[model samples]
Target: MTKFSDFANTLQASDIAELLALTEKPEVISFAGGLPAPELFPIEEMKQVDQAIYEKEGRQAVQYGTTEGDVPLREEIAKRMKKSFFVDCEPKDIVVTTGSQQALFILSQILVNKDETIAMESPSYMGAIMAFDPVRPKYIEVPTDDKGIVPEELDAILAKDDSVRMIYVIPEFQNPTGITWPVERRKAFMDVINKYDVVVVEDDPYGEIRYDIEKLPSLKSMDTQGKVVFLGSFSKIFMPGLRLGWTIANPEIIDKFVKFKQAVDLGTSTFGQRQAAYYCQMFDMDAHIKEINALYAKRRDLMCESMKKYFPKECTFTYPQGGLFTWVTLPKELDAKELMPKCLEKDVAYVPGGIFYPNGGNGNHFRLNYSNMPEDRIVEGIKRLGEVLTEALAK
Candidate 1:
């Protein structure tokens, strides 16, 4: 029998999907997976990209491209990012990645070491945490409120520790939480980091999904000292199946990420990158996103109303303006993981909120994603969940 290394021992499987895998409960409406609605996909636009890809760039799209990424695709991504984030940027600052997941992997390689520590929000994105866990760094959970991470706490931590090299953040409509950091908070968060020597890996996958309001400025847009390395993905807006994303950073770090990617998989799929580029340029992105937002907004409205109608008054949840998840906190004594089996038995599944915390500590909370299911399913599922909870608490 071969023994595995200490590094492999540090990684554990994520429970998000495992809860869903237990049974195909017909009545199960899962908020376990942070999935986007398939109906929102602009399939017709993608078909255009498919045709254009073969007609215009078939040879290049199919063949091996440079590890740095295809130049034209990178340029398109950069241009769009600059307009969206309202920040000055150049094509040289971008590196197209296989998914935002790969961007996390490359960053883990570049910035994290076995002995170093990463400061991150409590109940942050699980996928990001899981991506960095295999590298085996000390995980420090920073305290964040509905407004976002407390600046004083972060400043105090940074002031006390010289060893803290990196801080991971999801500033816009964060996964599991669905809490967008207000502009003033983004300013304060940026202000504190500006004084410190630490680096911020800004995650912004859901920034563009705003339904009720205009988009907020990104951390990278406000970054003046070149201290922020921003990550973006096409997964939420377009389709996760494309597996396309990009990282924006200083030339120095972009070079390292590019080199790390070269050693990892050489480059993101040339076809995928080209496909996204085509979707952006040729498609009616504004009209497409409007339709997506309208659908998700309706779903969100239904869930909120259903939760209020069925859930106990003691249960409180965040009302997200955009993005997929609604973070719910039951009574302090009621454990979320403990509630899982009962909820599943009732055929309603949700992600236990503890997994999102880098240090694994949010036991009373659960995340509900309204992005994937139909409005009828959303209503029915929440009603079922309400009955289970109502019955359990009465015991």
Candidate 2:
């Protein structure tokens, strides 16, 4: 009774979504979603901003916008890029999309052909993999370390394969792993990427959420060859309900995105764009972000300390400097997927890490998010998780 095409057959349900479904249970303590703390959201400020937008420009806010996006929002985004990423760019070079997720999908449409290769970090963002699935690109996994992707490994891979059209990387507070790249590695990556003609998709939704380290320069900032396509999102820093994100690339590349986006959604939400622009213009966004960083830092420390106190010596996890997640690598003989039901029975939940891989074979790993739960929840959840992990190791 199914009428779905082969293209539909290629897609599978995401593990992130599955874990998020578990989060809705009242008794469950979920470390599964990489969601920002609801307490940090500027609800009162947003309410005021909404009132102001309608009071002044209600018609324009509700009306359809240009495919390129609202001029003021684009201009504001370009300014923020210069300060944060250290890149000198004009508003014309940016294309506003529904979310950075859409930017990924649009880029996949514009750049990939059937069966062409895309070099990715071994445990990359599952959302990006899902976005690129319909294109059916071949994947080559490049190894990563505590300092992000290993440049030499990437160099060796790209050197032999000219068929790779793109190298997708998440250098800043990367999803799942929560590992950040150092300046040396970022420069080294650029050195290798410049020699080749492939595009580098820099998906950085958590770049600004640092805990106790200096900010590293973005790969896009060092991209003299125009090989980096930077994807920026407000979902992590701002509210996810707004669904505003952008693509920063060369003007020519942005032109292609603009055209394709026209066919996709015509434009991102006009009211949301205007409301976001007004809020940024009137509020101290830096101060708001600083408050958020401070709160998440406390949660991260609590989770790490709890793990140290409770987890078995055989289990090791990353101590993230910033970002929402911590990647745990269990003993090789154990399977994270097989451990999930046991965790759920303990009234706790986490994402099994094997799903982060495009080809899906690494079963000894899993990802945990510290941003959603409060300090008490983080401590108790990790304690419960520790018990689960210890029991698994014993068996």
Q: By lDDT, who's the top model here?
A: 2
TM for every model, in the order presented, reads 0.96, 0.97
Per-residue lDDT of candidate 2, residues 1-395 (tens digit): 88898898767775556755876798899998878999999999999999999899967779998998888999989998998888888888888889999999989889989899988998999889989987889998898888888999999988899889988999988898999999999999999998898999999999889988888789999999888999998888888888999899987788898999999999999998887799899898889899999999998988999999999999999988888999999999999988888888888998888878988799999999999998898888989989998898887
Off by over 4 Å in 2: 12-20
Clashes of 2: 1
**CA RMSD, predictions in order:** 1.5, 1.4
In model 1, the clashing pairs are none
Q: Against the unseen true structure, what C-alpha lDDT does each candidate score?
A: 0.85, 0.89
| CA displacement after TM-score superposition, residue 359 of candidate 2 (Å) | 1.9
Model 1 lDDT on a 0 to 1 scale: 0.85
**216-306: candidate 1 lDDT, tens digit per residue:** 8889999999999998888988889988888999988988888889889987888887787777778777677778888899999999999
Q: Which portions of model 1 show Cα errors greater than 4 Å?
A: 12-17, 23-27
Worst 10 residues of 1 by lDDT: 9-18
